[model samples]
Target: MASDVEDGVCFHCLQPIPHGVELSVAFQGDDKAVCCAGCQAVAETIIEHGLTAYYKHRDLDKPQQTPLLPEQLKELDVYDNPDVQSDFVRNTGDHSKQTTLTVNNITCGACAWLIERELAKTPGMIKSVVNVSNQRLHIEWDGSIIKLSDIIARLARIGYQALPFQQNQIEANINARRKGFIKRLGVAGLATMQVMMIAFALYFGVVSDLDPTTQQYLWVVSLVFATPVILYSGQPFYKSALKSIQAGSVNMDVPVSIALIGAYIASLYAVIIGRGEVYFESISMFTFFLLTGRFLELLAKEKALKFSTNRLTYMPNLAHREYDGGLEDIAAKQLKINDIIVIKPGETIPADGVLLSDKASVDESLLTGESRPVTKATGDGIVAGSVNQSATLRIKVTATAQQTVLAGIVAMQDAALADKPKVQKAIDHIAQYFVMTLLAIAAVTFLVWSWFDPDHALWVTLAVLVATCPCALSLAAPTSITGAVHRLNRMNVLVKGAQLLESVKHLDTVVFDKTGTLTYGQFKLIAREDYADIDTINAIVSGLEQRSEHPIAAALSQLSDQPISPDAIQNYPGQGILAEIAGTDYRLGRCEFIQIWHPNWQPKRQSNVILANRQAVLAEFQVDDEVREDSHDVICA
Candidate 1:
């Protein structure tokens, strides 16, 4: 679809667009476009002259454009520009590896669809996914074939700009969102208060006592005051309620919307009929409280959502691939199975793949919440988003973009959000029964009171209908869960939803995963003994350990600063390494190895390994795996 920019005035300059004027620069959903090249040239001049009118006049409805395809991107030749390439590589990491990029100008879900679709058009581009809410585009491509600058420039033509986000910038953006929510809440609160005051005067008949004709004046004043409050202050509630109904579901906002509308309509009827004794005051106050609660709940829910999704978002958006022996940058979302990519130290793995290199160590804490780094060997599986802790490594993608472990985490979050809380279900049940009960009570009260006085019965019926609404009862669950979520967020525990919190209160058995859950999974060098020289032994161990995936071998490899290469190494599965170093044959395994070498040597009972040459025992190493500090406390609690 064509962008909404053509239909609307420039938001930045607030100038009316003339007919038949072609756009010189296309504005993305969140940016501004100039009508001609002359306008753009002048606009740049204006910005250079320190006037921000260009920014002020920019269209905010323009959606973020997609990254360029390898063929389309070839026009820019970013790799030839050393400065651009350096900046790109610095921000995104090596062009042969995958890294993330944060794009600005994403506006809505449609923009996300467009960007993803556009990037997929590129040859050698594996995947591209745009997150509209956060304005980010994750791309995976063969860096050797595609240049990031070319891709970004193509996005610029469509009115979107991709900017790499520094860690500090992400934090600043989060703070800005918080400030906006606060300001919105403040505006709504002030408007609500003013409306409530006008409602109170109208309800108490303060103006009615002045004069009969003046009562109409008071009603008009009240209507004028309440209109803006309902339109502006309660807009979020209205939008949410409508969205819920459209989706064929009822949320907490549905009842609130119904109550507000019902009260307002009834009060409007009374005023029009010259019987202005209706509860307008109740209606106004009800809306005020409801909006206040909603605004607060939105803030809490946003925090919870951020917490649950933050770790997943840390994955790089782009992966580099080798094409014709040159580097190219592509969207991470476009990555497919069997694609080969490089990974540098401190860079995140972009997909579930098998390492092409001999060995590498990665921190898997993002996925399993474990602090230990896992050593992966050639042909070993590596999940996306795992941070490389050692030297650079190459891997061939084994899974597509959507089938990754991180993708599963995102799917889990989505499932969690879709599942209703037990409390919400209970509230739904109560609302159903409450509606029927209120109808019955209103009828019974009218019938019983009508026998005595018809007028009294009418008032009693209205009271029952208005007072018996399940607003407060329905509110109980959301309010409590929202409060609890806020508290948990403050403590750094992000609950995915209110339902998760509710489920936590009902959990009877906690199943702990043994490997990384209850234990401090990191391997430590408890002791190192040198037969001839400590440094020589360390270097030899590091060299031989480099090829092994055993945790003990990984720990020993990390302890030495010197480089060493192993010769004639042989692996003893479930035991240890048997190799020849400097023409000396040595076997390194559990304490049993030493006992076999020297019958007189006694082995320690602790988790220890002994090293021995063909002649006699050499040295013994003991290690201990400690449980996490809170493991026992959590178990006992």
Candidate 2:
């Protein structure tokens, strides 16, 4: 390789260096040929850290072929401003700011690992984690010393593009990925059917003593159909395998790519020579099934991530802000600190602010996991994402869009995703070595069969490669963990780390931080009128109750034995509902709701639903929070 360097060979990658290159570096007292300025910079960084041992270590590993740009070395002072950093950066109580960036051009796990390693070398950087599944990088650094743009620039220099993470961008990327996979799957499925039909016809013709020319023609047609199935649908596996090998590690894709390419090459040679048997049908079938499994798995991952995107819903799309001496509608992201915003009943609070009104009740179930509404008075601080249950109020904004406590929680969750749990790390360590062991076994099988049955050696080796590909083995743990996460998310139980699953199993006792954690904290029926009269009233009461989502409406809805059909249901924002049920035209809501229709009806002032007709009071339902039936069983378990 050193002799060929003078003839335009790269000393670092050992590939033919292109012309118009002035890149060179001195290593071990000799001038080495580098393909570009990026290679020279990487070589210098490795040697500067006394990591020249990697040069000798990577000799047996495949060299990287990624193209890097030199223009990314420009200064990044703009990111140091606090206003610009507020868009995507979150503060963790001190000078440290955490940011999650979506990266492009990540082909495999090694690319993520390389980006992480390079980022850790920067000054004032606390830590960097790269999630290979989504190609997202989570970084925490001190803003006082380093800026956000510097980290992004470093990633660009190493053949990757880094930008502030956005949900819409990720959704678009997922759609594109799904479309590509579906198209490939369709092509492979169609090709497999055509090839299998040709193969069956050829086999039957042999028994019927068909002519040689017709059999050759059918074989040629089958080869043409199988070609696209192997090259197009099977391309992803080969690309992943190459990246893994270049990074000095082996992944499950190595064996899969080998099996696919090997079978295609063998079958292609057989068809061209017209003497050996062809396995065109077998190759096409395998490719189709593989693509099908991969597409389904991709969909499952997309759904799992979709559950996580709910965190973004905390920020409202629009906010009512004080502007030009009156309230005006504006995008939530445009709101600045000290801006006063009005929030109505049942509306989600758009930002963290201080209450400017006398009193209000807010339900912060999304953040605190508490079902009961908490009361707040004037000058009290309110959090973003909490619902204003009752009473409209004005609040002065204290934090911007990405700097709120809710955004901080989202940033923490993302940071947790980038870190590997103990069990996951162990699994990854075992998987890396397992790939090497399989390669060795395949080699031994080939040599043993070549001694006695030389013609069957390649066939036996291919079978071994396919049978022990390790795809299922590597996927088993992640799939189970992902399903568990989906189930827990539905229950409002958020788990940030995978190791928590194993760790919780070994605990002697479990603890909850709040009352709602162990109890339902929802209203249950406490008192009612006579059943004979209540049953008749409940049938009419279910009409208005079913239409409202209020907790009281839900509690009342559970009393009726059957669902009642109601018509002309009208909702009053701050008061209640008025509907015509069974042509009785009853009103079931607060005392005010009944008084609106009947001026003489005087209902008691208490926590109860007033049910009345046009003339008199019919029945009243009382409710309160009671301990859940399953709470005791759950505590014991």
Candidate 3:
């Protein structure tokens, strides 16, 4: 291979390296010749990410192709253009621009720490925060000191690819990220199991009559199996540790990475010297567990985000706007106040508006908790996110996009998330110094062990670092809050912030609003007084109620399982029902209407409906609000 490379062949692609060409890539501490800038970039990207082992692990016959860029990269420069920036980037202040980007290949909190640390060193950076759960990078920077493209290019060098966040593509990005984590975790799990099997065989070799060469062979096999676990599955730990140290700070990952790598190196050295013990199983197991914890956190964060986005999903990207003389579909965000828009049957309302049509039936369950369709007439106000359940209607816009009520709910969720609880802020402050203290303990451990027993100093120190890394303390708090909020959303409770969660333990007096909160808004039959035969009452009431569209009619309709046809029925809107059955006139309505027939008759109890004839009162009916199933338990708890 060396002679072939010396004969004018590119070291990477095996293509002919042109005479006097100067392209090269650093690999394994040496420069290797390449055919062009593309080959150079590809080689450098591979090496810088600690993936140079791919050069050896890959099949020999694999074809090499290149798509790379030079130091003055052109592809990233497109992001610097104002047109490209307009999609995701926005000006927050005169000198500051902020954006949210989906970051690729983040496995844990340490990756977030690394990104933040590096960005803080840049000249123009104001702030950079990584949401480990969503794998998103939120950045704010001053434009005077650096360009946005340059910041992105800096991320590329640190082994991450970032793109402007697109809501339509969020689920796809989440799936891809989940798949990558699963792949890495699976590799670590399988490799750990195999190494443990080998570990048992090596233990047998030590205590039994196994030959020296056989024991050596088992150790070598363990090394081979553990290599991938350390290099690929455990890549994020090492990467984060290096960046943390380079930034003159310490992260929880620093101790973990040091312990894991230290063990591997120590075991490898012992293997080569043909003496001492190996800990491949320990290394493999650590990688698997760390990945499992991060995966769970990712899932919890995803669930929280889903609950938050459920409201926003009702917003349609386009709305039918009445333009000049014809209807045109335009971006919903472009809609303005008083803009007339057409809503078809079964389509969601694009904005809050007033009805221009004579009449329409709308399903407002998504916006309001009410399940029944509301009947709206001309000049009645309608809100966005309601579905038109009847005929097509034209509405004049009152609020569009973010100005709508649905957007306010979404914004409240964002505001709640932004306002961190006192405990979380305190924990964050402690966690910063937590790693430094762990390092101090490690230093004390190393020095004490070195004086007592020189040979075991490194091993004991590594064990201390690994056993007490404090990873769970730093991760558990925020994820628990997110998970709690998500669970509450499932129960139809909207939690504004972590303050509610933190203060739950001290909850004393619980006050609840009556209708639609503690109790269902739909009326429930409570009591009834009858002066007429039960059979006659059931048939007549069912017939009368079946004719009207009012909500109370449905409740009264339940008074009978079977329906009876009345000779004639008439509905007095917002009043009562008038019907005739068996040559008798029946009135089911206001007590005042009943009093007209019986001048001295009066109701003895509180009632919703009074059934009477011209002679006397026949029956009285009462309704009560139905309470929710959990209302009692919630109050007591």
Using lDDT as the measure, which candidate wins?
A: 3
List per-prediction Cα lDDT, in the order shown.
0.58, 0.72, 0.73
lDDT per residue (tens digit) for residues 417-442 in model 2? 66766665556557667778999999
lDDT of 1 by residue, 75-123 (tens): 4343334433322232223443333455543422333444555677766
Ordered list by lDDT, greatest first: 3, 2, 1
User: In candidate 3, what are the lDDT values of residues 5-30, reduced to their tens digit?
Assistant: 45455665555565556657776667
**Candidate 3 regions off by >4 Å?**
1-168, 242-249, 306-309, 316-318, 323-338, 344-347, 354-381, 387-392, 521-625, 629-637
User: Which has the higher TM-score value, candidate number 2 or candidate number 3?
Assistant: 2
Instruction: Supply every candidate's count of residue pairs whose N, Cα or C atoms clash at under 3 angstroms.
Output: 38, 0, 0
RMSD of each: 13.6, 13.4, 12.5
Find the number of clashing residue pairs for candidate 1. 38
lDDT of 2 at 380: 95
Q: Clash pairs of candidate 3?
A: none
Output the TM-score of candidate 3: 0.66
lDDT comparing candidate 3 with the true structure = 0.73
